[model samples]
Target chain A: MGEPLLVQSPGVPGSPVVTVAPGWAFAAVAVLGALVVVAAMLDGALSARSAGGPAGGAARPFGEVARLMRQRRRTTVQADSLLWRIGGAGLLVAAALMVAVVPLGRWTIFDLDVGVMWFNAMDVMVWALVWLTGWGANSAYSLVGGYRFLAHGLGYELPLMFALVAPAIAAQSLNVGKVAAAQEGLWFAVWMPVAFLVYLLGVAAFSVWGPFAPALGSDVAGGVRAELSGVDRLVFEAGRYALLAAGAAFSVPMFLGGGAGPVLPDWAWVLLKTLAVLWLLVWLRRRLPAFRPDMFLEVGWLVLLPAVLVQDLLVAVLAVWRT
Target chain B: MDMSPGGIPLAEGGEDRDGLQLDVLKVRLGPVLPHWPAGLVLHCALQGDVVTEVRAEVLDAGDEGRDDADALARALDNLVSVLALAGWEGAAAQARRIRDAALETGDRPEDLEGLERLRRRVRRSWTLRWSLRGLRPLTEEEVRHHGLPPDAVGDTYDRLIRMMDRAATGTRQDDRPVFRVEHLALLVIGLDLAAARLVLASLDVHELQADHTQHEVAHG
Candidate 1:
C-alpha cells in the first residue's frame, strides 16, 4: 500500500509528474496487452516446433483471429443467448478493465486509490464470467466446467486475497502506484516470496491456464468452452489469453517493482518485465500437471492460505519495526 | 419422456446431493468429443456435474483381424488420445507424429527409434503419471476375473506405462486372450467424469470390441 495518486505524483517531491493523456494511455495499454497475448501464442507454437510437433506459422494467432472473424455464429435452442454473449465477450472486457489500473512505466489509465483492490475485484469477476460461459451453453459438459471453476475459485480465493494483502501491508497503501513506489529500494518478490508465489498460483487459477486448467480441461471435452463455436469460441478463448496477459502485467507492479530499471525508459522496462513474467507462466504449462480440484482444495486451504497469512503477518511486523 | 424447450431430450427427475428432488441430466460423453476415443459413447445420469450412473458402449465395432502393425498403430493412436487428454499438447503432437510415421514404415529400426523416444518421454513425464496414477486401480483378481490383456491388467498408470512399453517393443498376441468391454464399467462407474475419461483413455477402448451387435448376431 503506497501513496494514493489523487493528490500527489507517485515519486518523491520536487520531480514533475510525467503523465500521458488519457486516450494515449488507454490505447497504449490495449496494444501492449494484445501484443503480450500474441507473443505467448507464438511461444507455444515455437515450443511445439522444438518438441518435433506440428509447427504453425508465426502468424498463426493472427490467422486464427481472422478465421474466427469470418466464421458464422452458432446457436442452440433454449440456450441462454444473452448470458452466453455477455460471458463470451466479458472476458476480454474484464481483462481490459483490469489492465486499465496497471501502470506501464508509471502511466496508468486510472490511478485509483485502491488499484490493488480493483485488480483483485476484476479477477473475482472471472469466476462468474467463466461460470456464465458454461451455464449459458445449455449443455452438460459446460455446466460441469462451470461447477468445477466455482470449486476452483473457492480453493484459490483465500490465498490470493491474502497475497494481495501482503503487498498492501508492505506499502501501507492499497494503491498500485504506491505499492510499486514502495518497492524502489528492494522488490517485494525478494522479501515476500511466498506471497509472490501464491499470487502467481492465483493468477494461473483465475486465468485457467497451465495446471489450473481443469475448468477448461480436455477430459470434459474442453469443459466450459465445449459448446462454443465460431465467434463465440474465438471471443471466449481470446478472453482467457487476455486475462492471462492482464495477470502477467499486474505482477510487475505487485512484485517486481513496476518499471524500475536502468538505461531504458520506464515503459520499455515495463514491457520487458511483463513479457518475462508472461513467458514463465506459459512455460509452466509444459512443466507441471494440472492440479486435481480435490487435491488442490486441500493444498489451498490447509497449506497455501496459511503460508500467505504468515507471510502477511511477517510483512506487517517488519513494517511496524521499520517505522 | 419430457423434452427441454431447447428441443433436446431430458431424462427423468431424481434426488440430488441435497436430498432435494432434481432432474437427472442424461448427457452423452462422446462419439465426437475432442481427445475422446473414436466411436465411444457414454450415457450418463447426472445430478449436477457428478455422474450418478453411466453406461459405456461403442457405436461401431471395429473389423476383426488386426495384425501386429495394426495393433501398434492402435496403441499409438490411444497414446495420442491419452496425452492430449492429459493436456500435454506438445507430447500429444509428438505422439501423433510418431503414430503417422509408424503407419508409414512398419517395423523399421528408424521408426522403432522414434517409438523408443516417445516411450521414454511419456514414461518420464511425472505430470502424465501424476494425472493418471491411483485412478481406477484394478486389483489383480479383477484383472483375471474380467479377462483383461496382460498389459492392461494393472491400474490406469501401470496400463499406460505398459502401453508405452508395448508401443516401443511390438505387442505379442497372447494364446489365451481375454478382452472385454464390460470391464470398463468397473473402472469407470465410481470415478468423476475427468478421471473416468482418463481411465478409459488409458484402456484405449477404441481398439477393443465394445458393440453388442457382434455378440448378439453370433448368439442368434
Candidate 2:
C-alpha cells in the first residue's frame, strides 16, 4: 500500500515523489518501531507465563539480563581478557550500525549508488569481528566456532553474491532502488524465479538468521557461540537480531519490489514488506529442520550458485530484447 | 589458713567484722589487637560469680589529664593479671565493675557503650564458664572442658555443675549425663580440679574409668 502522504497535483511530476523531512521521518519511525518491539515483548511474556508463580516472563529475562550485567565479569579460562572485552564490544557496535544502515521503511542512512554493496561490507565486518571474538576467548569451542564460521561463510557467500548481482543485471544499475523499481509492473520473480529463490537461500546462509544457523547450534562445535557468557552472550544475541534485521531489509527489494504498494507510503510499504519477510524468517526457524553444514555447502555450490548465474543470463537476454 | 572441716574456711575465722569486708582486684585483658578492643578492664571481688562482695576499676586509653580515678582503675586492672592467680572471675568482675562505675560516672555515650559491652561480655564469659562445668569444653578430650588459663579461672566449675544438677536432675551429685574430656581439660585450665572432676562425674564419665587407666598406663 504505497499511498502518498501529502499528494500535490504536480509536485515536480515523476510518480509524485514526495520527500520526507530530514530526521523527522527517522525520529517518528524509531519511536514507532520501539513501541512495536515493546508490544512484541509483552505479547511474548503473556504467552510464556506459567500458572505456579506470578508469571514473571519479560520481567524475569530483563531482571536476569540486568543481574548478569552487574555480576563480576571474570573469564575462568586463561585467555587474553583484554581481547575478549574489546572484540566482543567491537562486533556488537558493527552489527548495530549495519542494522541502522538498512531501510526500515523508505528511511535509511542512504540508498547509495552501491546500496547492495553496503550489506556485503557489513557482512564481511561481522565475520571478521566475530572471528576476533571467538579466537580471543581462547577456548576449544570458540576456536571451532571461528573455523565453522569461515567454512560456512565460504559455502554460503558465493551463491549470495550471485543472487545480489542477478537482480542488478536485470535492472542494469547497481542501485537497489532502481533494481527494486524495475520489478514494479512485473516483479523480476516472473522472469528470474530461480534467482529470487537463490537470493532468499543466500540471505539465510550468509545472514546467520536461518536453519543455516551454524554458530548458535548446540552441536557442531556449537557454531562459535558456545563459550560466550554474560555481556558477551548478550552482545552476540543482539548482533544476531541485528543481522536478522539486515536480512529482512535485503529481501524486501529483491523479491517483493522494495516499497511497492498501492495505499501506503513508500517507506511504510518498505516496512510492511520487510516485517513480513522477517516474520517468515522467524517462522522458518520455528518450523523447518536445521540444515547440515556440509549438505548446505553442497546445495550452495552445486545448486544455488549455478541457478543465479543462469538467472543473470536470462535477465541479460530480456534487457537485450527490450532495447 | 583456717582449716575448716569442709577444707575451705566458711567466713575467715567467723569474724563478722562490724565493717565492710570488701576485696578488689583490677584486671587488664589486652594490648588486645584492634580486633580485641583496648581499654577492656575488669574489677572484681574474691567472692564468686554472684559477686557477694565487690568494688571495681579501669583506665582511660587516651587521657592526658590522667584523672586520679582513671589512674587508680588502671592500676587495679593492671594488678588483675597478678590477681589471675587469685581468680579471673573475681579479678574480672572487680575490674569490670570498676570500669563500669568509672565509665558510667562519665557523660560520654561512645566510651560508655563500648566499655560497658566489653564488661558485659567478660562477665558473660565468667557466667558461661560457671554454667559450662558440665556443658562440655571445646578442648580437652572434647567432652567436658574449661575456659581461660588454669591460673586465670576460679572454682566456678563445681558451682556450675551443682547449679545444673539442682536445675536439671535436682541433685549436684547425680551422675547421669556425664561430661567429657574436653570439659575436664577446660576445668583443668580453669585451675579448679575439684570442680572440674565433679563436672566430669556428672557426665557419667565414671564408665570411662577403665579407659582412663589404660590411657594413663600408655602415657605413663
Candidate 3:
C-alpha cells in the first residue's frame, strides 16, 4: 500500500518489497521449474535409497521426461480430449499464478492487494482441474480417482480456508507482503503452529502429494492418471511438483518469515527456505501411508477443522489485545 | 437403454446404498493390475466408487509347483503388495529388498536380519496402523466358511502384522486350504473400490484355484 518501490535497490530497501513489471513473470516461472526439478531429484534419490539401489536414480526425471516426450499419445474410445488436456495442463498454469503474488525477498510480479485470497482461489481451481482430468479420461478407474480427490477436497478445503484466515487476521491485511512483514520479531508459524501444520497438510492435499495421494493411488492402477501416457502424463506429473514448489514458496510470505534471514540476500533466503520446505515434503512421501478418503474425512472435520479454528481464535484475540 | 456411445455402452441407473438412483458402471478390476492377485478378476457393477455388485473369477488357475526354499521370499512378496497397496512406498521398497535378497541367496543370515528389521519397522508405524485399522475384519465363522487360513482371523492391520511375523519366523503352513476364486466376491461386496483393493491384498491370498463350473456369484 505504501510506495510501490518499483526501482528500490536490493539489500537497502525501506518498504522491504517492490512490485516488479509483469514481464518478469517468466523469471518467476523459471524459478518454479528449478524447484520442481530439485524436488523430483530428491524424491528419486530417496526412492533409490529405500530400494537399496545405486545413487544413479537421481537422474530419473531426465530419463522420464525424454521418454514421455518421445512416446506417442494414448487415447480412449470416448475420451473428452478437450477438457482432458485442459485439466492436464491447468495445474502448471495455476501454480504459476500462485507464485505471482509471492514476493521473492524484495520483488514480486503481481503485488495484488489481496494476494492471500488469490492463492486460495488458485488452490480451489485444483479441485476442478483434477476432477476434469479424471473425467476426461472416460475410464472407470480414472472416474473413481476423480471422485476420490473431490472427497478429499471436501475434508481439507474448509480447514485450509480457515488456516489462511489466521495469518490474515494476525497481520490485519490480506496482502501477503504485509503478512510476511507483520512477523517482524516472530514468525506466525511459531505462535500458530496448529494453523501452520494444517496449512502444510492442505498444500499436500491440493498437490496430491504424500498421504493425500489416494486419487493417484497404485491400487487403482495409477487412479486418475491410469490412462495418461507420453507428453500428457509428463505435463500432469510436472504440474504436481510445480504446485508443491509454489505452495512452499507462498508459505514464505504467509507462514515462514519471508526473506528474513541474516548473512544472505532476501531473495536468496526466500529460495533457500522454499528449497528446504520442498525437500521436506518430498522426503515425507515415503514416511506416511495414503489417507484413505473415508477415514480421513472424519479426521479432517473433527480434528483438523476444530484445532485450526481454535488457533485462529487465539490469533484474533492476540491481534485485538495488541491493537 | 442399450445405446453405445463411441462403441462403449452407457451406464444404467440403479439404486445405491442411500436409495438414490445412480449410474451403475460395469468396471473390471484385475489380473493385470499392479498390486492385484495374479490370476483373479472382479467384474464390478459400481455405483459411484462403491462396488454395488461384484463377480470374481480366476483365469488359467492351476497347480503351479511351489519352491520350499523361497517360501519366506514368497511371504515377503505378498507383504510387499499389501504395503504398496496401503501406499507406504518406503516400507514396500524395504520389503522388496529383503524379498530380493531372500530369492537370490535363499534366506541367508543377513536376509533374516533384514526381515527382522523390516518387521519391527512395519510394527512400529502408527500411521500404517491407523490407515488399515478396522478394514474388512473377518470373524472366525467367516474365515472358516470362506476357507481362509487361520492367520486371516483378524482385521487388515492384524493380518499385516501376522504376515510380517510369518515371514520373519519362516512358519509356512503346508496344509492350508486352496482359496477358491468364488469367495472374493463375497468378501468385497459392500465396500468401495479402494477399501476392496486393500481388503483383497490383506487377505494374503498366495494362490487362487479356478472354479471349473463357471458359476456367477452376485451380491448387493
Worst 10-residue lDDT window for candidate 1 chain A reads A11-20
Off by over 4 Å in 2: A1-64, A76-78, A81-87, A90-92, A95-107, A220-223, B1-220
lDDT of each: 0.76, 0.48, 0.86
- The digit string of per-residue lDDT tens for model 2 on A1-323 reads 23325323232223212333344445543533443354334434543431112465546546655776876655735566677666566654554454443444444444456666776677677667667667677554465456556666777777777777777777776656566777878777667788767666655655555455545544223445656677776666555554565566677776677777898877777777767766665444422334434335666688777877887887788888988
TM-score of each: 0.89, 0.50, 0.94
Steric clash pairs (candidate 3): none
Count of clashing pairs, candidate 2: 44
| Fnat, 2 decimals, each candidate | 0.41, 0.00, 0.90
Off by over 4 Å in 3: A1-16, B108-111, B208-220
Question: What fraction of the real A-B contacts shows up in model 2?
Answer: 0.00
User: Which DockQ-derived CAPRI band holds candidate 3?
Assistant: medium
Question: Which candidate leads in lDDT?
Answer: 3
Ten-residue segment with the worst summed lDDT in candidate 3 chain B?
B211-220
DockQ of 2: 0.00
lDDT of 2 by residue, B4-113 (tens): 33342233321122344422212222233211224322222221111122121222333234454444343333323212211232333344454455545743323332
Worst 10 residues of 1 chain B by lDDT: B172-181
